[model samples]
Target: MGSAVLDIGGNTGALVVVTGPEWSGREIEISTKDQDPLARTRAAVRARHTGAGTRYTAVFPTLPAGPYVIWRTATEPAGTVVVAGASVTEIEWWQLP
Candidate 1:
């Protein structure tokens, strides 16, 4: 699971990603709010291995207000997070059989 905050101050927020008990230290990516030409060419926001078991945290220190996509790789299963001003949006990922 992961989260991002929406604020007008351009402050960074924390995102916690949880794959499962079997997976740890997985590299995950996040997208910025709204659509920008630079957004596609820009690097995907990456989550770091928290070293806290199966949890990864990605922090955007200067994130603009909008919705962001939190995913493992592709946009599918892309958890949509809406920031309404300094609020934490918790998102989770899963694998289906």
Candidate 2:
């Protein structure tokens, strides 16, 4: 499971990937555009319970500002997002292409 706590500011930010139950327990990988595709970071999908309902998410608590590629597999990228400093970026897993 991933940590819900986030500390973002300045040249740092965070990413939240909302996923489905099928993704639970899976580790999602991401890499900055400037880095080699083989260089990646991983976060585990966890269930979050809220007043509205339960949500499955993978949280990248801290990351540098840049274009990041979210990988669907070792050789496939699901999508990309430009992360800005001092912000929390959220994306739905199913919306990736």
Candidate 3:
């Protein structure tokens, strides 16, 4: 986390997606909201064995500035994100309902 504010009109930024504790071994994806995605990243990491994780975190760097969403499989439990230049936007969601 930094002190810089989001530059809404700038070209790119970062997105951090955090999932609920029980989301181990699941695949998470990011897509531009209402817009076709320019790219997608596959996130797979488990935080269950430690027995103390608050959430599973996924970081997407240099994403185009705009609205996006985090989804797993069918996208039911998705959370939204906004990436503004040089800043990081966070989206937190629980396991699929």
TM-scores of all predicted structures: 0.46, 0.94, 0.59
Score candidate 3 by lDDT.
0.60
**Candidate 3: residue 1 lDDT (0-100):** 22
Candidate of highest TM-score: 2
**Cα RMSDs, all models:** 6.4, 1.4, 6.5
Q: For model 2, how does the per-residue alpha-carbon lDDT over 1-97 read when each residue is reduced to its tens digit?
A: 3338998999999999999999999999999998999999999999988877889999999999889999999999999988888999999999988
Q: How many clashes does each candidate structure show, in the order listed?
A: 7, 0, 0
| Candidate 2 Cα outliers beyond 4 Å, as residue runs | 1-3
Candidate 3 collision pairs: none
**After superposition on all CA atoms, how large is the RMSD of candidate 2?**
1.4
Model 3 lDDT per residue over 1-97, tens place = 2122233336778766666656666667877787555455656534523345345666565677877766655645255666787677776665323
Pairs with backbone N, CA or C atoms under 3 Å apart (clashes), candidate 1? 1-16, 1-17, 1-18, 2-16, 3-15, 6-85, 12-60
Superior by lDDT: candidate 2 or candidate 3: 2
Ranked by TM-score from best down, the candidates are 2, 3, 1
For candidate 1, the lDDT comes to 0.47
